[model samples]
Target: MAAILVPSLLEVLVLICLVSTCVSSKPTNKIKSLNVIKELNRKGKYIGLITVTATEENAFFATGAFMPHSKHPFVDLAGRRFFVGKVNAAATTQQLLDHFDLKGIIHFGIAGNVNNSMSIGDVTIPKQFADTGLWDWLNPNATWDPSSYVAELDFDNYNEPNFNGSNNLLGHLGYETVQFFSESGDPNTPQPLLWAQVSEDWLQVAATNLEGIELEQCVNSSLCLPEKPKLVVGLSGSTANMFVDNAAYRDFLYKNFNVSSADMESSAVVMTSLSNGLPVIVIRGLSDLAGRQSGVNAYATFGSLAARNTAKAVVQFINNIYSFSSS
Candidate 1:
C-alpha cells in the first residue's frame, strides 16, 4: 500500500489563493528606501512591464483599454505590455508596483493652467514638479513674503539661521532629494536644486513624434472652445492640495517656478517615481485657467477635450516606445 502523505501549510495556502484571486500583501523592501524597487511577484516570471498611470476616468481612456481594469484582463498592445490601473496619487503609487517589473512610468491628465499665454486645451510636458504647500516656519506670527515662495530662493535669504530643511517633515526616502520648498520662512533656499526632473531621453523621443499633433477644439456636440488648441513642451508644474483658481496665485506660481500647470497629483507622482530611480514623464492638458479667468469653471466645459488631447499625445508616445528598456 502507498504511504499516506499530508500537504504542507504553505502548499494548502497556495491552493486556496489560486481558487480566489485575492491580492496578497506586497513583499517587503530590503533597503526601505523610496528608490528601492518593490518585490515584483512571488510567483510567475517577472515580466518587465511598462505602464502608463492616469488619475481620472478621462485620462484612463488614454491607456487604450476598452474596459476597466476590473472587468478586462491585462492585454499587450503596441508590441509592449499595456495595462490600465486605477488612478495613482503621490500617496498610493509607491505601494501599487509590487505586481509588475517596472521599466518606466508615464502619467497623463488635465490641469489648471498657470501660464496665461496658454489657452484651455493646450497640452504641456512639465519640466519639473515642486511642492508649494510646505511652510518653513510653524509660528503663526511669522509672515510670508510674496517672493518667498520662489523655488530658487537662496539659502542666505532665510530669516531663521537655525532652520533645518524639511527632512523630519518627510522621512524615509532611500535617495537624497534636490528640491526645496523654503528654509525657515526664508526665501533664500538653494538655487538649481531640482524637485522632479522628467527623463530627457523620453522628451527627446517625444519632442520629435509629438510635434504637430492636432488638439481637439471642441469637447462634444453641445460645447466648443473659443480657439483651436495648441501644444507646448518643457514647462514647470506646481502642486498643493489647495485648488489654485485666482489670478494672483497663478501669477505667483508662474513667477516663482515658471510653472505652467498646477494640479493636486502630478508633483506627488513625480517625486515617488524619481525617488525610486524610475523614469517618469508628465503630460498635462489645460481644462481650466485654474481660476485665473473669470466665469464658470471651464473644467466642466473643456475637460473632455483636454483629456482627449493629452491622451492623443500619450498614445503617440506609447505607439513608438521601441527604445524603452522593457520594450
Candidate 2:
C-alpha cells in the first residue's frame, strides 16, 4: 500500500470550499465555523501553531486548557495565543493564514519519507522545499504565456534580508520539477511548478536548539518502530498533491533534490507564508517510508508516534522562539 492515507476531513473541506470559495451552500459545519470566526473576531492570537489532523492536534494541545474560538480551534499557551486547526490542504493552509493574522506561522504534522537516514518516528525541520507533480500545461501554439507559467522556478533571486544572517543557512538553491503525462488532461508540455523556501533564521534556531533532541521509537509496547527516531534539521523535501508510494520515485526525489521528507501541504504553506511576507517554518515527523520498507504501512502503525515527535519538536521550537524574543 502507498504511504498516502485517505483524504483527511480538512482536505475534503478545502476541496469543497474551493468549489465555491468556501461559500457555496450553507452546510451545518460551515455554520459552526462561521460562528467560531465571529467569536475569534473578538479575540484572535499572534502565533498560529498549525496542525492538519486530530492525531497532530492531540499530540500538541491536548494537555492544554484550549477552548474553541467561536467553534474554531484556538488556545492560549505560555502567555502566547495559539490556534490549532486541521489546515490539511495547501489552499486550506493559505486560507487559514489569511483568515487569521499572525506574526509567524508554524506547522507541525506527519509526513512521508524514504531517506534511510531518518526513521518513521523521526522529526525533520525542512529548510527548503522543491515542488513536484505540479505542472503548468503550456501550449506551444500560445504566444502569450502567463508570467507564472515559466520554464523554471526562480529561487536564486529571492533572498531574506531580514533573516539576520548570523544564523542563516540558506543560499543559492536549484530546485527541480518533473515532466510527465497527466491521465486526465491532454498530453501537454510540462513546466516547473513554484519553488519557495522557509526562513533560514527560524531554521537555524530550530537546528541549533533541537539538533539532538530525543525522538520516540515506539507508540506502545505492542507496536514499535524499526529504529530509534532522531531530530534532523536543514533538510530538503519534495511536495506534491499525490501521495508517493513508489520506491523509485522516492529514491529519485531524494537523490535529485537531497530531500529528507515528503509532504502534500508543506509546499503550499511555504508559498502562502512567502506571499504574506511571513517566515513560515515546517516541523514534520515521518509517518511512513514512502514504500521503501516492505513491512506494514507505517502511517497506520506509527502515525501517532510521528505526530508526537512533531509536537515535541514544536514545543522545543516554541521554547526557542521565546528565548529569541526575550533576547
Candidate 3:
C-alpha cells in the first residue's frame, strides 16, 4: 500500500509541473504574436502628417471638409502641405505614433493674450507651460498669486540685470515666451538648453511674417533678440474654482511675472510631450488680454483673428521645416 501511494504522489507532481510549463509557454508566444501584429499594423499606416485647427468655425477650415470625420481629414497649406486631423493631445499623440507614425507634432490653436503688448493678431510660440492649476497641490501657499507666479518664472530674463526684470505687469505677456525659453533653452545661446528650440525658431519666423514685420525688434533692442519663439510647452490652466476675474487678478499675474498669455490646455500639452521625450511646439494667437468680464469681450472681439493668424504661422513653420529637410 505504501509503495502504491508514493508512485501516485510522484505522478501528480509531474502532471502539475507539465501544466505550469505549458501555460507559461502559451502566454509568451501569444504576447509575441500580438506585438508583431501591432508593429505590422503601424508600419502599414500613413507617416509624416501634421494636425492643426482654429476656432470651431475654422476648426475644419484647414481640413476643407465641414462635418468631417473626427480624425480623418487632409488639407494643403500654401504650396507646403501636410495632413490635417482632429485629435486631442493623447489621441493625437497615439494616433501619430500608431497610424501616421509622425516624426513629431505641431499643435496650433487660439489662446487668450495675457500680454498687454500682444496685439489681437499677434502669434505666440510658448517655451514652457506651467500647470498653474497644478500649483494648487505643489504650492502649499495658495495665498500666493497665480498670475505673478507664472509671469515671474515664464519670460526670458537672461539679458535683464540679475535676470529679474519683471514682465509681470504685462498679463500673460511673458507666459508663452517664458514657456518657450524654458523648454527650448535660450534661443540666443548655442547649446540645446531646452527641448523645442528648432521648432520655436520656425514659429518665430512665421509670427514675424504673420505680423507683416521684416524684423521683430525687441522692446529692449539692446538685448539680443531671441531667434526662436519662447514657448511654454504645456497645457494652460483651466481652474475648477471661481476667482476674481477683475483687475486685481490681472495685476497679480502681471506684477509678479511678465506673463502675457494664458490658456487651459497648453501646459498639459507641454508636460505630456516632455515626459514622453518628444519634441513639442505651441503656436497660439492672442484671443484676449488677461482680465475679467471686460477682458472676455476683448478676447471675443479679437480671438478669431488671433486664432487665424496662429494657424497661418503654423503653416509657415511647416513649410520652412519641409524646405530645410528637403534641401
Candidate 4:
C-alpha cells in the first residue's frame, strides 16, 4: 500500500511540473515583454520619438489630441505625430533597446527655470546639467549635500564665442526668442524675464551617449513651411524632489549649479538614455522661474507654452533625423 501511494504522488508531482513549464513557456508571456520591440521592428529602421507628460494637463496639451498609441498602450499626441510613453530609467532603457531597435530618441517636454537669465517661453538646449538636487549622499567623500548636482558647460567660462556658436545657427533661423512672463507688471514692479538658448555640443554629446549614434545635419526648418527638421540639443538636470514654488530652494540651485532650467523629468531621461546607449535629446522651455516673487500664476500660464515649444522642437528634431536617415 505504501509503494502504491508513493508512485501516485510521484505522478501528481510530474504533472504539476509539466503544467508549470507549459504556462511559463507560452507565447503570451514572451509577447508581453517584447511587445514594443515587435511593433517597432515591424516598422523597420525608423526614428523613434518619445514624449513624456508628467501631468495629465501637460500630457493633453503636448499631444494636441488625446489618444493612445495602438501598439504601445500610450497616449498619442499631436495627430499621432509622436507616441506618448512612460518608463522608469531602467525599463525605458530596456524597452527602447528591445523593441524599437531605434536609431535615436528625442525627449521633448517642459521644464522650470532656475536661472534668472532665462525667461518664460524661451527654449533651452543645455550643454550640461548638474544633478544638484540630491545625488551626493551616495558618495562618502562628497562635499556638497546629496540633494543636487550642477551641469557644467563643455566650453570654457570665458569662451563666450564657443558657448554662443549654435545660437547664431538657431537664432538666424528664428528658433531663439525670449518669452515674457506677463505684460501686467506695474510700473514699480521689477518684472522677471526668463530666456533659453540652445546648447549645441551638449546635444551632440547627449545624442551620442544615449543612442550610440551620431547626428547629421538635415534641411533647415526655416526653409520649409512644414518646417524642415534640424537636430537640436541641450543639457538638462534631474531632481528627486518636486520643485515647490520656493524662493530659498531656487536660490540654492542658482548659487550652486548655475542651472538655467528646472524640471521633474529630464534627469531620468538623460540617465536612462546614457545607460542604454540610446540617442536622447531634450528641448525644454522655461515655464516658471524658481523664486517666491516670480509670481503665483506662472506655472499655470507658462507651463502650456513650454509644452508647446518642446513639442515643436521635438517634431522638428525627429523630422530632421528622418531626413538624414533617408538621404
The C-alpha TM-scores of every prediction are: 0.62, 0.64, 0.48, 0.51
* Model 3, residue 322: C-alpha shift (Å): 1.6
Candidate 3 lDDT tens digits, 1-327: 000000001010000011111222354354554453244334332112222232522532443222222332232211212223322111221222322234344555665555565555566666544444432222222244554433333223323566465443322222222233233444445331122232454344444444442222232446322342233322232211223244555555545444555665555455444434445566676555556445355554555555555545554454454343334
RMSD of each: 14.0, 14.4, 19.9, 20.8
**Worst lDDT window (10 residues) for model 2?**
1-10
Ranking by lDDT: 2, 1, 4, 3
Model 1 pairs in collision? 34-174, 35-276, 153-189, 154-188, 154-189, 155-188, 158-186, 245-290, 245-291
* Regions of model 1 farther than 4 Å from truth: 1-55, 62-95, 137-194, 323-327
The candidate that achieves the highest lDDT relative to the unseen native structure: 2
lDDT of 1 by residue, 35-108 (tens): 32222122212111121222243353454422323522232211222232222111011123343344455666
* Most accurate candidate by TM-score: 2
lDDT by residue for model 2 (16-77), tens: 01211122323445555555544443332334455666677667644332323234343322
Better of 1 and 3 by TM-score: 1
Off by over 4 Å in 4: 1-39, 54-95, 135-238, 292-294
Comparing candidate 1 with candidate 4, which one achieves the higher lDDT? 1
Comparing 1 with 2 on TM-score, the higher-scoring candidate is 2
- TM-score for model 2? 0.64
